[model samples]
Target: METEDDVPLHLKSLAAFLIRHHSDQLRSITLSPDPKLHYPLYIDFAELMNEDPPLAHLVFSHPIDYLRFFDDAALWAHKIVFDKLKFEKAVEKIFIHVRINISGSPLECPETFPSIGHVRVKHHGILLTLKGTVIRSGATKMYEGERTYMCRKCKHMFPVYPELETRNSIVLPPSCPSQRSKPCEGTNFHYVENTIICHDYQEIKIQESTQVLGVGVIPRSTLVILKDDLVDIVKAGDDVIVTGILTAKWSPDLRDVRCDLDPVLIANHVRRTNELKSDIDLPDDVIMQFKQFWLEFKDTPLKGRNAVLRGICPQVFGLFTVKLAVALTLIGGVQHVDASGTKVRGESHLLLVGDPGTGKSQFLKFAAKLSNRSVITTGLGSTSAGLTVTAVKDGGEWMLEAGALVLADGGLCCIDEFDSMREHDRATIHEAMEQQTISVAKAGLVTTLSTKTVVFGATNPKGHYDPDQSLSVNTTLSGPLLSRFDIVLVLLDTKNPEWDAVVSSHILAEGEPGKEKDEHLAHIWPLAMLRRYIHFVKGYFRPVLTKEAEKVISSYYQLQRRSATQNAARTTVRMLESLIRLAQAHARLMFRNEVTRLDAITAILCIESSMTTSAIVDSVGNALHSNFTENPDQEYAKQERLILEKLKSFEEFPDIISME
Candidate 1:
């Protein structure tokens, strides 16, 4: 009974194509039982539109209307394929979804392409493409789409589709459909819980990638709803491009004046974009400049490495050792799995404890910007659950959510105000730091997640830094925790007039006009190029320690152990491991295939400098006069006894010692 105008042109054409190629699509679907892999037919929208100009014009003009007709056409194709396959009763339960891939001409259409932040009410029911980072993902659950209701008076069964706009509300038919002489009151409708068709549903929050936004601007996020085969397609921290329709849901509670429910994207197809590289598109000239930089620095890797180090936080003057260590930490060592199934973490962990105005937070923020996958968190704000993983109740079911460390997996996690964190929260990262894995046993969920995160922790010392206090005492950190870090650098505000003058000059120069154009300024990589360089090294290079490098490292370890005046608890096997890791990282920075003796020496020098700055050793490389001694707590007692003995000796000379 439908007229020609009532039916969309694209829908009729799509039906004809499905009837023609029904067997081919059905064969592809039957091969894969997994819902994720069950996407057998991918209708290329661009190709279809190109073959039919009228259909393309109709689609381009009325996209939202065409999308609804397209869904119906896909459903009709699904039925045709399902019937042709003659699938078993059990197999029929698994619905094979038909996904539409938009590329070429369709992607060029302005109406189909919209930024995540630009989606509005005008875009409702319109199919659009969006690219963003998945910030949060909810657990998949079965949602009842259609429910059967029975009339209590006549026991008449009726099926109804509930509107899921508001939080918790269901709409029923005004009256029963039974052809009774007397009209039945809609109030007597009883819910039939058993007869319901449930579909897999999930919600995810996608935020604009940092690369797309201007510096210092906060990213915007949008809620996306996935149903049936699309549920659980993506996870947190994934950069994805989704093709879906913009839809809005109404608030369930009509009494509430404020409508809290926002428009959500109902996704049909999701594709993961590579996150290892910078998402920002660069100009042709800028890309060429990066290639030229690589060519110029390919022979002299050490020079290139130094340039990169100096470039990071140039405003913060004079912490060469700390800067170098941070640079190496950014390009971490190679992960290795031994024959015995032991996995050694390749990531480097650095802890910076310094004076109040020494730019510790600045370093952390710079590192976050430099790395492609990085997260910055503070001690006061982050919790044990927030750092690793936590269980949350979503749709009446407990779902595991990823935290900062988990979300920053295979990348960097910068923690500012490290000392201000609670002891309980700090204890949670013990396993994650050493083993590179977080084990969660909460809410009846027992699972271990891979962290693979390099920790960059910055802290302030307790009150004024005392040279007499050990690193642990100064920072209020445990000995075990301190030992885990590959390098612990301390920055002090010393009274060197000459050094202070140099720092002052640099600070003053920053405010001057045309300072960026000064030829005297150190040559540093651009932010985009620097990020790309890091990604290149991490992805392609995996340097191993040579025999000479191994010998150098072994000799240094033995020498440190033999010259120990006090029992060096800090000097453990972990230190030796850290030494090797640093050496490997150094080699990677230089674009070398193997760690040389010079790399090992550089690593040792870095460790020695860190130890000296931390006040663990004196200027001449000897242990300081403090704890790590035999009975350190008894020092006060020893001092008191000596005082008493001295007083007794002075008993004979009462006139020399006057008593008030």
Candidate 2:
């Protein structure tokens, strides 16, 4: 039977053209000794087909046959270069990876490509493209290309190179070729050890990207196989465009009727899609709406910023400061990387600790929906491994599987019920929160995975809010963990009849049809436009603090330090950094190039609200007082003087003082 290694007659001409015109490119690839340095030779399929009329007709009419022929041609071209170079030791290392770019083709268009839900058996053996997010990636392992089997009865050795179409099928040779006393059936053949040629292999699971899925529809995923140079190219949560051939294999266990078999993509090329690319092109109508909004609020930046805060979670009533903080968390500060390769993360982390019915969960869900890429999980259902990374057995070898935090890299990770998470699981996020990376040292795999994700956690306080309890104690979180958050807003279910009536009216108005036409509500940008505006800010805006802003922030920090009590939840340098981040975010909201003093003052006010509510202060009727008294040295000195005066008076008039 003909095999894949046999080059077809029609492909020989293509092979000749590749050797004649692309010899230098092949030579350079062969000279690179490192496998990691290997780069695929990109070829334009349209251009190649235009050069060869016969090949063009065959490729369009019979794609599968043309693909096989193209593979053979690539192999032949590589062999010719190997012979010409005279690099005998490197001949086997020189692999020709042909990546065909199918531009402007209907089959290769992202919109026309079949989703995992629409894929069927008819798609097998055809070239296609897929767009999705990688949910899981298996460890790279060696895949056997050619195997040698030895018969036990006659000790006869036979070589077999499995075809790509039937690579996963379970089949053994019918009979052995040894001329023994009786022909031995090769039923008891054993694989010869150390006689197999292997290639690099990895498997990844891809789920449909969120933008491609319909509303309220759960995403579907499919397995993809990547070999050789393509292994280890992508990680979980990466949005990718994959171009490859679809192939199906028999089930590992034939008795399993529920899942008999499934198709897998053998990826020929993979490209990472820009996560923020969709934000650049806002719809014309939405842009016009935003322009009108700008016109209304252009005179007052503060009014425009408050409008954005109100638009974040319009359904929830009366937490304007908390909503503003959340908005800043979404539009993060500028990340700084110095010459020494040290990186300072600019993404802000927020924690919302509230009463049972204070809309914490609703706000979290709203934030998750607004972000372009986000993952939502509850602490009760989450594990340490599930939040970070876990080692799992695949094909008798351990593989590293990405968790929620890892998968949410470069996005937001919303962990609801933060107080409900186990102690160990809660501790697992410390490194990720501070360093912005996760380090895995399990199953002999030692690698650091980037988790540049903004963590937005929400939890209910323990029982009721007590004046004596600090924020950390109320939330059941340690001081070290609590200090990592840039802002910790405490939401109380305060009862005010006037405020309650307003909230009730807003809730009722939401169900009414004409409420949106109100003049007051007209200035608020549509939810879609608001989300795209945030994305645009994050992509383009990186605000720096001016001298005035820096001075204001410094003064506020010093004042807080002087007033802070020993039991204050967050009084460290992290708070100072948080102030800077908030100020930068505020500037970004106004589309300003630099943070002004007004921005710093706005940030300070938000921080003070969070600190005062979360901490326990002893001052009488002073809401802004930190949990500690100011000027402790002066108070102690005054007490000492009063004690001295009393002692002197007691000594001078002992008889009259009634010493008893």
Candidate 3:
């Protein structure tokens, strides 16, 4: 054992600092009886800076040296409890590793390089952090970190270490340097049994987020190494922030292949960002404003909601139903379990069958922006394998790599040019849409990955005017696939003179200085405000149906089943769930957890707009051209009240609702 005087002055100070700040944590590890239960102690770097700035800087500037000191000091801090056991004996099996936590946002932390791409030659051999998505992950295996060998003749132990900050094999001393009254020049050495410092190790590849890169610029990816407690914590498609030492490893040496050094991060701490997607910081002031705004319109909930809805795609004038549907789709519904132990998905899929130049892509882009995490790709640009999951060989090992749906597990995936996709590719999304999971059994690597993503698809019709045919015939989409979408709105180029004049004036008015296209947008929410609100509503409220709401949905569903004609594929048991989900979403949008009859009626109207061929909604004429009215609440009340009365007396009629 090294005496107190033998320990370096700086390391002794570090150990003293550990004892002063984390005596209780150190005491727990020292007092633990089972060696197999060895756990690393987490040290926040912020506290270290407050205690000793020089030491904190030293830990980052020279992590390889300070990290070894951390392991050694952990045992030295508890001489009272650990004096009974030999230092070497105690350290071999139960050494406590110190994982330095940078604290705060990893992206903004001081010790980290700006990003994965910003890492350069100057950043190597130091502590740093990186934030990216894991596109590929390898299987866990045992890694020999350090090895010990004993001289055959002298029986003296000699430690062999690998290259600095690398995974290269350890090189032993050619001759023993031990002095036993004479120089022991033994050429052969005996390997010590059970003297290897091994731990669980895994390799993963991380690609920088596409959101951070410009268009046409491919996202950069780098290799990362996880050890000990860090292994197996992250899988493909997970967004993670890893703190580690920046290092390089030599690629496999081969006759034909050139040897190259690839940069890798040997992870110390890994934090997943999947659950943190909706963790937007909502200020108390904003929350108060939300409460006050809702209170102001207690008698007019729809009006208050319309003010926020207009913010969705303010550039595109009108289309109230489409905006409302977009809001519900983004807010989503409460995912719950039924009595049969089956999990019902809360994700609502929306399909926009529209003509060119009708702002379909604009809605898709705006929806993607509202989501905290989203992937926007065209159907022709992606395939079934790319949309789901695939097993790829990375470093000679077959491992699962996440695709688009898996990558957007907790967010949105917008597919434009939907009709350009081949039929074979479209057929592969059945399980992903309905079950919310992507199962891959390729390459003997069978696994099921979650795809809890909201699919927002926008496709043009096969040709022109086909209102007489079903959506399947018009768009060439299958019945089963059409049923998965909760709402399918059509945007036609009617070429009406009045509509064209209104749209042209709206576009031209934006160029003028004083003229605003629509006065309703004066109170519309901004992108940041809308994002926070969507995250808040999705995370805060879980609405359930009231008796009246339940009755309304059930009655409408029963009537649709009885008089099923056109759009027959759209009306099924799944439609009932869709109605409930949309109603629940509307209730949340209304700032309440209890769905009301009005919410149910609104859900029915949205369903009607998707199911029928009418150019306008029930009361509103030509929904595409409908603008904000003077009294939206009154308008909403009159239309929904009529449906409420009709639904109440639906039992006696031959058909209260029909698909004709």
Candidate 4:
């Protein structure tokens, strides 16, 4: 008889029954006196719990064995207590996540195992226990009230319930009502109509409650990748479930796991799982609002706000970076907002530039799971017109299928193998990036679609971006496309041994000791909330620049552009405009209705710094320096005329000129 006081509230109900059932087995157990017993036993227990049948049965075979195991377990118990205290202390020092990972094979299977068991981890010797189960191999993805197929050949169907036998599928309704909402249909039978179709060798169907069992043949496509199989497998259209610690800085959106799977993993998962044959439904308002935000930034002050925004999100590059930077500049400096009651748009871009194992593809997988908005990753190699802009078709009036960009509007669009992208196909993005809209003119279906998205692109630099080729000429990207981005961040796996250690340690910490905690994506979330806040402010406030702010901006740009060439100077002007917008945005962040001198000065410093960097680079930088130093503008024109005149004179008097 277990006393109520001896049991925790959560475990009290089951303790009495469990003790009664295991009394015979419990009586055979004993504790060993060996000092080293706990450490080895703890390892053994962890291994056992990780397996299916488990090693707990060994404890019940004899008293000596039980005693030995208990002694070992004691040391582990103490370690857990010590580790918990250390974890608490660390948490107070900083709010960052700590992680660890350990590895071991499944526990040995034991005969006559109990229905339930406990798994515990002890750090520095204090034990923390958790209840878990070793999932049986034959288990299927099935749930109550779901429908089972009687036979694919005969098209037989039946409801899933306690009475149904030989169940092999996990019940996955179209959506979870508790988390989302259940589809409202006439009968429980209707719930399974749109449920995922699995193709396996054998089929099971309900004949009549207790008599329900296997039927005939199954579909060839029935072997959709299971959740457990996701680590190594990637098939198109399959819905995959993955869980991992979120890392916000590595990708535009937060990534769910540390695994190195690519965006194709999710793409394949969706392709295999969903049979809808149509595009996922996306709200139009979200699309419109994203475009509006992009356009609004054109007039917003940018200088300091751009720096602040980029400082906040360092991973993205190009048009994606520019758009967000512009948006943030407007919101923080100008106190601007979009038509939708949201702060400047909260979006991200991903630039994957390297060979395999560079985390280009894996980054996409992580972002998909971490973002609040939908994640759509497409292949530059396999993607078609239907993958980007709206494509036209038959008598259905060329219904628009929201491609990755369309769906990812107001969110993220990750593109893999970006260098492999077809030139014509890549051109589709030019309009989208600059105009914030995708214009389609294919199959007589000319229409404009919203592609206001943060494009995360991955590509391998040609021959590792030839260091000898000069920074401006060697870039694999075309000048026009490169120019679209506000910043171009370079990622390299340096030869630093310390970097390797840090990366390895970071991955390892995810699963060990007192490191297991929910990975917080607060950085990304705060930006989102800020966007909403900006929207509120814009709806209520209209900010303007003061004379001092305007004059300071004017004088700053005049001084900065003195050395820049004609075209390069134009960029400076644009930079100044961006700075002004940013200053206005900072004023907004400070809860002001007008740009202040402080905001203008802050914006100016950041803008001037970026201008300096851009102006010093090869192509734009040379052009900028030439405008002032070499007088190349007039000198080059005269030099070209002189060359032409000399060539003509030489052609007319070749004999006399040679004699002289």
Candidate 5:
């Protein structure tokens, strides 16, 4: 037991502060039946700062030392509630966690939390908060924290602790002190195993999210060590904000080796940032802005929707249909578990089969930018192992490393030149796309990793695209995989002088966007606000299909099934699911929690545009030059009336949809 004078002044003060503020919580932990179990006391850093400013400073600067005091303070506080003898029964069981949160809070600034690349040698031994995606996690191991030793010369008892300055090694005392005034030389000591203190330890590497990095800049990663309750709490692909002491670990020693020191974080707290809203905090003002924007165009809902659509990829001249598809794909539908306990994925996949120089890669890049967390890779560069999880031998230990899709678990994945991937590799993602999970059984590792990600793929057609041929023949993609996409838009670069002239004028006028008063450019949201808006709707809205919406969607499915032009593989049950998801996503885009008939009609129109097998509305045409009509509301009304009549003639289905 450490005496009052044996503890450091700063640590003692911190302990006192905890006892003052969190006595009730500590009492509960002490009263628990299991003495060997370690309990976590989550201490919010901001609250600590408010309660005790200097103590907060001490914790921020000397976390490794102050955190130990916190644990010890917890012990004394618990002892106050319980007996000293009982509290001392298991010293290792009493621990308080310093759960620092800087993600969406005021403490998230660069001074409190810095990017991985900004960590320098000066930051070593300092408590720092860093945010990144977990790329790899090591096996849990038992770490020896404290051990008792008896001096061989003077029979003096002492404790040896792991040294943080040199990879947590223990140094032997050169001499033994006798309080009676005699000092004896004790170069050797006997190890006492009975007084050992140990805890669970794990190592994980976190890479700074590429979404925050500049173009072409490689991401930086730091090794993190988790102890006690922190082990296994986070896995690969999870975004986490870790607060810990920055230290360096020496590389393995070898002949003629320089013995490099790698930066490592001894984590005091780790908070996962997997929640959609937490990824991008939508401010009240921004939500108000969205509401006001929509309110201004309420009479013309399609106009308001077009305003939002124009915000996407505004730098590009115009591909209104493609832009709308991108927006819906990002703000995906709601995921629900069916009656059979099977999950129906809400993630909407978009495939762009276009001609070369149709800005296919541009859309891919733009979509990646729109997403808060995204991974962009070309099909040729990605293998099955690279797109999914893989087990690799790292530092003589097998560990699971996340791939592109896994790393972008909660967001989007853009694969350009998607056709260049091997068929085997393409086949591997079939389960990941539909089941929303990747089943791994490789290298003696068997585990399922969540891949709840939207796949935005772009690939050029196989030579010249033929409308008469099936999608499989044109894009060389399997029908099963093609069916997974909610929207498959074809962007053909037809040489029309009039259309080309308009596109050319738009492109030439791009540099002077600020000077133009064009309505399309009037309500374009900036990248930051757009990201917040997308995440806002995705996190908050879970639109359910109205009765009318259900009937319309069901009728469309039956129509597609009965249409002579139906492709058997493409018009299956999955297409119905896709229609529902698309309708729900459209409802979200309209800022509504109910999927109305209008939302259903818009979804059907998007589906109709991609009907490569049927000639529902002009068969198929180049979507690259598709621009918003002059009066979109009237156009929508006309299309809605025609579709309703079409549905009615098939089976006398009454139209319940209203334009108002």
Candidate 6:
């Protein structure tokens, strides 16, 4: 006759009777001036630290593990629950708790206790309250008036002191008042089951007082899945809160960690949140074309469909930063996946080289997080099988889950530690990068997976870079793979104390991080919106060569000959395509009928700015052919001097000889 909800119904009646006149304010209240800071309840963990001493010299080893145990309310009531708790300037010794019930004992208690009450449990041979107060130490133990009790029915023994009341005797409110008031009411407790209340943004849940289960937190750098409503809040470019079951990061050995959430959650959240409405001002005909393209491509899924690419073609005035480069790179591109996983596909790939601590990893992480599809990172020694094709024994047959490139097929693959990748694995990507597909042959599984991945990768200088500036690709990535990338952005961590101050201030709360990085959603999310924009334009974008644009581009190739040995005409043409595609994409973004002169000009300028840097290097390398052996100290000077010399020589040297 007793169902679970019925028992809660019973307890609700008794709780109301006992607390009918009590004021709600009697619950916990914490005061702190900084709204951003969390005020955690502290306990004297010094005692627990002493009892469970860690390995020598390992102070608070396994902090994450230690944090996990506090889920038990028995631990909360007996060892951790605090009275008048405040951890202001002091290190907050927040003791996490988890409960384990002792059966076959004289204590005739229910299987679990409610979260609000004092749980009576035995630990370390002592009968203790959940608040860490000793109810009854033991018969042989020394305590004030410790009572001994025996249950006749169970024939088991327990130590019970008169001060501790039985659960049936103590009646209270169904819900804790602390969570029912003001801001805490809606945000603090989310109703799950009829009797269960999830606290702390629903990432954590509390059972009855006897048991507290705590799930592990995802790494701050992790890609996590958000719930349906939470996904809606996170629009493209807008920084939205994402909350869901946290999953563990993949280990080096690729073993499963049950601690994290399922991947299904991520796929569903991305699909739902990526939905967008068509721009209102678009022509009816364009809209029809857009719809047709969506239908045709909807079921024909490509790799890398998660990144939102925005193309802005303004002239370069300010110095380039990773944030700026990544933003620029996204303009007019397809976010698809391949054998490599989710990637951003553009006319050109991007390679970033810099010193350590230059915010390279941070930039990559930000882009990967913002992108709709998955972003998989790999390092040196990462195998082709591990990255492109992974085979598993599936029910007596080989099953492949796919590699980072394959998963990123329709999105971007931003690889950190790029130079560390083994040459064989590095070689495997050359085809994928160029052909935009990977042909696999393993265990009789041969197929060409779409690999239109736009690779945004970073690496440290081979050794210590020049103490003065950014590291060049000549030093970090192999020349072959380096050539495959569409654009190579150099991130320099400078010592200009003023810029350093600004960066530090921004990362800290001292200065506002430009526009919250969240406001860009209108231009950022619905990567599908932009893709449709591209699809609409490509149908009629029969881009003819503007005589002026062609001349400007040809002059660019001639200038390249005046500078370096590289046959830059191919590069020049590729850059032209990148510009055309980018122009079309930008035109779409602006709701234009067709690509215009302004669009082409904008694309030309951005592309030329990047190519100019390469041209300068080419000229410099030829002039100083003997001085630089790709060695360290001389490399920067060699490259710089070569560029300057080429700049000077351009006036005298004929274009053909200087170029290739």
Q: Which candidate is the best by TM-score?
A: 5
In terms of lDDT, the best-performing candidate is 5
For model 1, residues 1-660, the per-residue Cα lDDT tens digits are 234454566666766665565556655554445644335356666766666667756654565556546655655555555566665431232444555566555465656677677787777765677778776787777777678889987888877765666542568777777766887764588888787767788889888765557768787878888877677767766777777777677633445467566778777677776453435445667556645665786655455556666677667775766777788899888888879998988999999888887788988988888877787889999999999888887446676777888877767899999998999999999899999989889898787877889999999999888866677788888878888898888777776677667778889987988655532212655665667666666766788888767765776666556554332545778888899999988887666678976587668766775574421233212111111123322432453343223332443433322221
- TM per candidate comes to 0.75, 0.76, 0.91, 0.36, 0.92, 0.41
lDDT of 4 at 523: 15
How far residue 407's Cα lies from its native spot in candidate 6, in Å, is: 1.1
lDDT at 106 for candidate 1? 47
Indicate the worst ten consecutive residues by lDDT in candidate 2: 619-628
Candidate 4 TM-score versus the reference = 0.36
Q: Tens-digit lDDT track for model 6 on 1-660?
A: 223353343234322321232212112312223323322322322333333344111212332222332322222222111233445322222222221122222221332211112222211112111110001100111122223333333333333222112211223223333422342221222222242212221111111111122235221122332321222222111111121122232222334634332121111112112222212235787577545544553432110111122222111112332333455454444333558674444434666666676656766765564444435476764687767766555324554435667655545677888888887787888878877778877677666766656678877767655524223333544555655655565544456666555545545563444644432322233433444454444344344444544443444445654554443432544454455455544444333445554444344434433442455434321110111122322343354344334543656433422221
Task: Report the Cα RMSD per candidate.
Answer: 12.7, 11.1, 4.2, 24.1, 3.3, 22.4
Residue 588, candidate 2: Cα error in Å is 1.0
Candidate 1 lDDT (Cα, 0 to 1): 0.70
lDDT of each: 0.70, 0.73, 0.81, 0.37, 0.82, 0.39
Report the lDDT of model 6 for residue 19: 29
Evaluated against the true structure, the overall lDDT of model 2 is 0.73
For residues 1-660, write the lDDT of model 5, one tens digit per residue: 466676566656666776777777776676566767667777777778788787777777877777777777766656555554364442334555545554444466787688998999888776788989999999999988899998887888877888755767988766764454655766778887698889899999999988788978889999999988899999999999898889888876667979888888988889887874365776798788878888888899888888778778887877888998898889988889999999999999999999988888888888988888889999999999999987888667789999999998988999999999999999989998999899999878889999999999999999998888888889999989998888899888778899889988888877674695444324776777778778878877899999889988888888888883546667879889989989999999889899989998888888887777652555334678788777889988787877776776665456534423
**Considering only N, C-alpha and C atoms within 3 Å, which residue pairs clash in candidate 5?**
none
Residue 149 Cα positional deviation in candidate 2, in Å, after optimal superposition: 16
Q: Roughly what TM-score does model 1 have, to 2 decimal places?
A: 0.75
Task: Sort every candidate by TM-score, greatest first.
Answer: 5, 3, 2, 1, 6, 4
Instruction: Tell me how far the alpha carbon of residue 415 in candidate 6 is from the true structure, in angstroms, after superposition.
Output: 1.2
Instruction: Give Cα distance to truth, residue 100, candidate 5, Å.
Output: 4.9
